[model samples]
Target: MSDNMFEFAFNPGEEVVIKIKAPDLKNKMGGETLQHLMGAKREMLLALRSLLDDAIARTDAADSPAEKTHIDIE
Candidate 1:
């Protein structure tokens, strides 16, 4: 490993393992921050899905087009 990006050489079949540790990230704030952000994103996706399902359900039965499950149309 080298600090200078322009000066590094690697063998053709060499195996390299990298380990990174973040004491700050593992601390209270960083851990909680990531957890909260992930939770919010998951909730947002669920809410969006619910809204889409509701809209689809609300469409007029006659006006609604055929639904495709998996097979290609074209």
Candidate 2:
């Protein structure tokens, strides 16, 4: 097994709540691959709420500036 890991932080001033050990990709059986993939998906689902909230906040901030900008196109 390799020492590879994935980490995601969805909010500022908070510790990373999701950490997944990377799947061994060099040579894996079908079941092994599926298991690893499912583990990663589960971790993502656990963080989905925070992730969605962060995404919405960022999109709103970006849209606000775009709305204030005036462009003239000929």
Candidate 3:
């Protein structure tokens, strides 16, 4: 993955709240809207895969050997 593919950001000293107003049903086209969202989700999955590849490469280079491994769920 290329660095230009996606971006991440943080707020230095504050939190933000966002609200979205969905399109009014009278103005919506069902099949078209569903197709658009499906395409967006596909792109999101591609982006996530790229990010994971980058992170794994960095971690493999930096980590020290340990005796045991563990997994946890949130």
Candidate 4:
């Protein structure tokens, strides 16, 4: 719950977290601090958008006879 990091639990046993700290990411990507900060935000937004869209599609397709699935790849 810190200011620079965020943790999200998508399901009871599933988890998804996203942390973006610009100062800590200095010189990591090919850009300045501010640029990297903004880029990270944009990328994160796009990723979340895609995830939400997929969730919506699945929800609307609840009538489909798809069995529960789990993939474990380590």
Winning model by lDDT: 2
lDDT by candidate, in order shown: 0.57, 0.69, 0.60, 0.69
TM-score for each model: 0.41, 0.28, 0.43, 0.51
Alpha carbon deviation, residue 38, candidate 3 (Å): 0.8
Top TM-score hit:
4
20-72: candidate 4 lDDT, tens digit per residue: 44345545545576686778778987887898899999888996787899999
**Which pairs clash (backbone N, Cα, C closer than 3 Å) in model 2?**
none
lDDT of 4 at 17: 56
- Clash count per candidate: 0, 0, 0, 0
State the lDDT at 31 in candidate 3.
80
Give the range where candidate 1 is weakest over 10 consecutive residues by summed lDDT: 17-26
Model 4: lDDT equals 0.69
* lDDT by residue (tens digit), candidate 2, 1-74: 23555665578887666566755554554677777876776787768778879989999898885447778999
RMSD of each candidate relative to the true structure: 15.6, 8.7, 13.0, 11.9
- Assess the local accuracy of residue 67 in candidate 1 as a C-alpha lDDT between 0 and 100: 89
TM-score order of candidates, top first: 4, 3, 1, 2
How well does model 1 score by local distance difference test?
0.57
lDDT comparing candidate 2 with the true structure = 0.69
